[model samples]
Target: MFKFQLNAITAVKALVWTAVRRMEVKDVPTPTPQPGWVLMRVRYVGVCGSDVGGFLGKNELRRPPLIMGHEFTGVVEEVGPGVSKDLIGRLFAVNPIIGCGHCRYCRSGLKNLCLMRKIIGIDYPGAYAEYVAVPADNLYPVSDPVRGALAEPLATSMRAVRLSGAGLGDSVLVIGAGPVGALAVKLLSIGGVKDVTVIDINRNRLEWAGRWGASSTLSVTGDEALKSLRETHPEGFDAVIDAVGSEDTRGLAINAVRRGGRVIFVGLHDNEVTIPGNLIVRSEIEIKGSFSYTDEDFLKAVRVLESGLLDPREGWVDIRPLERGQETFEELAGTETKYVKVMFNPGG
Candidate 1:
């Protein structure tokens, strides 16, 4: 039998040369699956703020020339032997982190901290391309109406929610109304938390947060918002979620958390914020940092998406074409765009 082999496949890719390099798009190799791997036809990919910062070279969190996307969704195109062939043609959300299953973090079910962790778009090839080969372990199938690519960030919001210990009927002060924070508000409401408040300098984000379940949205340019917070939570907030990751937001979290309350830091701020450690010790305030989500988080995210609980089109996401990655990111870096979440539909 004469067999025909495919030569080259074209995919739009975001390539960042060392930090501060202009992103370029290029056609790359079509990946073939290895054992335990599945090939996906890239459908949608979300550009992250980290991708921008890394593009700026200020932090240079990712190595150069790698595809830059972690939040993505696709359909299984092919699977290697020993893999579940039934998964082909099924929609799936990509779990970017690859962990060793035997390590302390992995053993403890905290694979996000696995010593050998390889995050997609960071240490490994990523989904910002037409065809991506990933470990079958990293794929999660989705049913009808299928989950949008934005579900990844929704999962991240839930992760922060769990980390913050925000419970039903609890009061939460989210110190950033960005996509993740805004989604956090949605998750909080769905989780049955009462009286959710969102703070963001961006007026548009604040408005969006309100639509996403924020009981109160405040723009903290002065002390007026602080006064409002004081009146709302006379004692202090039950939980403070620092989603901005800025030094100012960190301080705000510390100040807003009630004695014995919990403060969860979910943002990736560049600088450090100084807080009264003695007061933290005296007040018994629990300050914790939430990293990325775990497998369980991904599963919960799948359930949430599958349930149609979150509708990104309902004021949470901005979808664009994959080829516009560069321009889109540049626009996002600007304060005027008023975007909460941006996802790329590569296949579109």
Candidate 2:
């Protein structure tokens, strides 16, 4: 039998940190299924904001010379021993977290907090290539191949909203209208939080959030936005979600949240943030830090996607060929485009 050779977009390290000369396409051998692993012929792989951060060397968790992609979907080409062969040719979306099942967090149903978790792409080879080998347990069969890979990000958004403590009829404010933030707004609306307000620096994104079920949108280009927010919502919102993870957005979440209300921080763009200690103490605010999705969130994400209730159509996603990964990454990281999400089609 002839061995399969495939093309992959890899992040190569450069001497200069501020250059886009890091990523390039290279031909590599197709990965094979290992024991308890399965081989997936990658179909669609979405480029996440974390991937942009990783490319820009902002995320220390992922080093260069890596194949960076985790939010992806593909067809099972081969299965290892102990795995049923009946899954061959099934389309599946991958859960990138490789958690040690016996860990305390994993055993407690908080697998995203597992101490020994190894993320695909960050810790292992990912789906930026034509083929990838994943643990069979991490794969979920998907029905819609076009948007099926969205389960990963949708799961993250779902986890954030679940942590926000927002329920039916609650007035929620989302600071950021990016992919995760937009998804959070849509999910919050579905969860029965009818009064949703989205804030973003980009008017295009604010409009996008409006279409994504946000009851209203706010354009926060500068300091004046805070004044406008206070004038409009003098009492603040029942719940606030910070999906921008910046000093400004973090402060906005703190200031825009009602006293004794909850605030969930989900964005990973910034690692460190300085907040007013006295304000938090005096107001008795409930601040929760949400990371990756738990196993339950991932399963629920799959069911939600299968339901077709939260449709992300329109200009939300831009599909490109795998070969154009470098330019697409640069485009998304550069000026604000109408495409909130970029998905790479490996087989295209």
Candidate 3:
């Protein structure tokens, strides 16, 4: 038999997405764990690039009056019926994607590709609140709260790199030096890819990419950026990953990769893009779209975080109280700032 918390709390603070480009902290009723679920006390929740797009009304899938946050870490506060009591008080990184068990994709362990999958932040209530209910099976034990929050994004990078088929000594070009792109560079470096180049209009991001593992960093944009890329590597790269997902970056990825090279699209900034189909066909460039990570990728990310191979908090990530949600979103949506990643502490 399982024991439940007798004195369950009721209200908690949360950052509520009220409308386009608007979010406010409000008092919300604390979530109660349902069967096979556990309530987690949120510690840190990272603001993903997709969250920024949602804030600007760019992502059509995100609806208003919702709690938007998927990248998070917290402690299991209470468990519902049939859940292990030992999970209580333990820190955990959540996979966030819950799929229908019978689907072929879910059966194959590719829950991210399941058509019936329901994501935490989008389909259901998310971790932007002080407490969130998650499936017990989705929990992965973690030590550090802040670093654990990074497991989701790192999983994304891992999947992109894996799909690219980049290996030892492969020359790869990553477009965009944002958090995902920079993480990709670090992963490639650890995987033995020595010649990795990162290009972004943000000098600060590019500089941090250099420190993270990029063998070369270019702070350029537009046609000039393409010109520089061609001049720098006339032979083209073995694999080019477009982490920006803009039309320009998409075009650049195809043009910068060698004939028969791989182009991995991991960014979702633009839903529709015009690409040169002839060039892709003629060059025989392999293009693949990488979405969210699988369960295995999420676990590998947690292990990587546990191994201390990367320091996500060093000079790039900013932590703020939930009260700053509006301002932070405004800042990130307006001008490009030096801050690469912004996380909210709901407890504050």
TM-score of each: 0.89, 0.91, 0.95
TM-score, predicted candidate 1 vs. hidden true structure = 0.89
Best by TM-score: 3
Off by over 4 Å in 2: 1-21
Clashes of each: 0, 0, 0
Residues 155-185, candidate 3, lDDT per residue (tens digit)? 9999999999999878999998877898999
Candidate 2 vs 3: which has more lDDT = 3
lDDT of 3 at 136: 96
Candidate 2, residues 174-291, lDDT tens digits: the string is 9888889989998987778888988886777778788778998887544677777778788888899988777778888888888898999988777777887798899998899999
Give, for candidate 1, the lowest lDDT window spanning 10 residues.
1-10
